[model samples]
Target: MNPQERPSWRQQSPEVQQQVRQDSEHFRKCLDYLREHSAGEHEGFYGPDSMTWVIYREPVILLGGLRAILLQIAHPAVAIGVAQNSNFRGDLLGRARRTYTAMYQLVFGGLPEAMGAAKRVHSLHSRVNGALPAGAGPQGEGRYRANDPLLQRWVLATLIDGAMEVFETFVRPLSTEEKRRFYEESRLAAAQFGLLPEQMPPTLEAFYAWYHEQLAGDALRVGDTARELAGLLFNSPFTRGQLDELLTAGLLPQRWREAYGLAWGLGQQRAWRLLKGTMRRAINLTPPTLRCVTAWHQAQMRLAQARGARPTVMARVLNTLDSYVDVPFSIRPVAAKTPAADRD
Candidate 1:
């Protein structure tokens, strides 16, 4: 049978449909709880908007869990290669390399904000540190130092990996034109950050500046879409003015309006699901105040076993791993720590 003709949840067997309904109901309850409880102040860099709330609530936990699985199942060489080719070696290569490394660790290690809402972030942070080459890891133990090369790489890696996950897991296969458009947009955004194809910056400051700029552009695009949607809703033949007013008043947040760009582009539903999944994994792997990348990794292994992967998904994911490892970066086995020699 053609893959497109395969039965979806709605067309499943009666028992399977019942299970899906139960799961959907559970998910709705979870979402409602998230909407209610995530209102107060946040302890991170982002604020108390719906997007931020969704991010901190369940999605982070889910994404963290996914990251844990990816780390465990994926070969170490794949991680290292992704870290290397992510940026170009150039003037200030040391700083550029460090910034990318930090990005990777932040995403892979899962560092938490200072506000103390999520402690698992730090657990993954420490695990990645332990995994890093000696003299290369998070600086000062808690905060991501601007000067730390390893930390820089971790940060970059996280962004790239997170974005890629959304692309692969959620976005349906795109046409060649769609793929070109997406890359074109990404490239244009990257260029605005002073990231030339051959001259990528090698420091945290440059990376952050560029990264934020890209996000800003994305926000603008999203904002435009939101406005168009609002106009459409308002001008709809069946939409009463009173109802529109109620929706505008109750549902729209100003921040979301301003930062409305969809990271998943036209695939809003899938993007939203992917984002929620990412957050959920992130949170589950490291609950507030706890530090344990190993636990997260173990959890992923269990989940994979439980899911009973089809040979095709397994093969594709493995191919991704192989492609990842082919990037030019060093990978070494985890080593046993030894005591330092005493000074004579």
Candidate 2:
């Protein structure tokens, strides 16, 4: 069968068939790559009950992602690795796509696919180690490793924390218990990636205490490479203008804003609040399935329930296409690596 061919649509009316055909062509490559990578026999790190899953798949992934990158590059090693090893600046969209794909695979891909993704990350990180660039603060940390558990912990922490920030800011606020569960699940995910328990602080309190303390000092100060990336990220053109980046900047701690040489004034603060409020209202307006990353699966499940039968493999694949949105390529601008990465 042709990779893009949708034989399952044969019995459907012309309208449905046309829509499915467009979807199949639109998402063919991504779907094919996913199919080629099997989940194998290993069970995934997170089940449906996992809080990590609930928070990770939101529409604000890019918003939280920007914060995660800001946090990652604050680490000199991660900064240096991204500056010297990755082509983030030269091709920010490509970088963003690669990073998000790895994340999606971990969360949604099959077990074998997830493990293979992890190993590939390890291999990539193994090649990204060396001295931190000068002027990155006195506590230079000597060297940076992509696979360093300590670094990995911080990177994962940013993703965990940043996701909550975006979720609460734009999506609905999580309950206190939900927040705690999310952090615990985040730690669980990190542990599977070889991050030790001690590497990740248990609670949100520990995260602020441990990591925030680092941010306040030399350890998390922005290096030249980091600053450059941060500048590019914020200054880049987006369809939404710089409103998205400005909103993100407004959410940053004053100390971090200063570190990046970004000065947020009252005007920016007001604008952020106004825009955020509008966004909050609009989220409710957006379709429920469109808001979450699992929309395809959710839609598929609904269809199966309605049909009173299981969906076939082709059906599942095609449904994934229906949920596809070019997240990284848009947000109206360019967008990761300031904090740690999936592997490290």
Candidate 3:
């Protein structure tokens, strides 16, 4: 079918139209509530930084969620083939690939840009490690150096775990079968990173702790301070209160305060300020509302056909046309607080 010639909601049955109307209304309500709450004191919660977080974070969550959904759909032996053939698997794998690529860019590409100022601090840590007495600790204490490659693997593992947790929290819920699928997929990814399934941490908290240890070592190597690491990863300034809140919210691990300090050394206050402005614009813009009246008309036609009504093609076309009315798009000035700063 020509893209523009595809049937509209009016071409669907009445039942479908009603369902679309209900869905539209539900979405509108949710959007309205978000806008109202976003304008309050908790503006930061809905700012551009937050939107970027969601955009970057959503695919990981969806990949996990869909894995769960597929498992549920495949529970019955007879449904396995149907589930496999559905486009869902392809869509989800694409999302996973995109997320992985983004993560790689964040760590390897953005890291330098985000941590330029922390190089000196990392050098200081390297000097301290080198100057430590030969008998600094017990016989085996220095065997596993902080900068070991193995430790870096562990840190990546924790990042994966954190990503998964965020997915579970904000995204759609899944069935038991879906959860099983998620585990299986996670295990495969972990294997690629040189980690055995048996070595995975049992709880999210434990994984985070392990992850932060790796970050600490990386800070030492990169000559960054704790604040710098925190700023790079969380995209926020390193304040004591912010650190406390991140820990409480399970956003960052506790022992890496020094790494976070180093990370803050590379902070760009202007980037965050611009992000805030973009968020304000996004929240104020109303989402386009869709009316699936054509679907309703189609349903009616289908019903009439089932009853041997024998309606002519012209009548069907007219019915579909009558069900919809388009209003011109209008721009309205939205009244909201001006952003704290303006950027070019």
Question: Which is the leading candidate under TM-score?
Answer: 2
List the candidates ranked by TM-score, beginning with the highest.
Answer: 2, 3, 1
Better candidate number, 1 or 3, judged by TM-score: 3
TM-score of 2: 0.72
How many residue pairs clash in all the candidates, one count each? Answer: 58, 10, 34
**Cα lDDT for residue 280, model 3?**
35
Instruction: Please provide, for model 2 over 6-121, each residue's C-alpha lDDT reduced to its tens digit, 9 standing for 90 to 100.
Output: 22435555754454445335333333333343222322455445676677656575676777788888877777777767776667767776877677656654455555675566
| Model 3 Cα shift for residue 89 (angstroms) | 38
**Predicted structure 3: lDDT:** 0.33
**Per-residue lDDT of model 1, residues 7-84, tens digit only:** 554565675455445534533443333234331222122222222222222222223322322321122322332233
Arrange candidates, best lDDT first. Answer: 2, 3, 1
Superposed on all Cα atoms, model 1 deviates from the true structure by an RMSD in Å of 25.2
Model 1: what TM-score?
0.21
The numbered model that scores best in lDDT is 2
lDDT of 1 at 23: 37
Give residue 16's error in model 1 in angstroms.
56
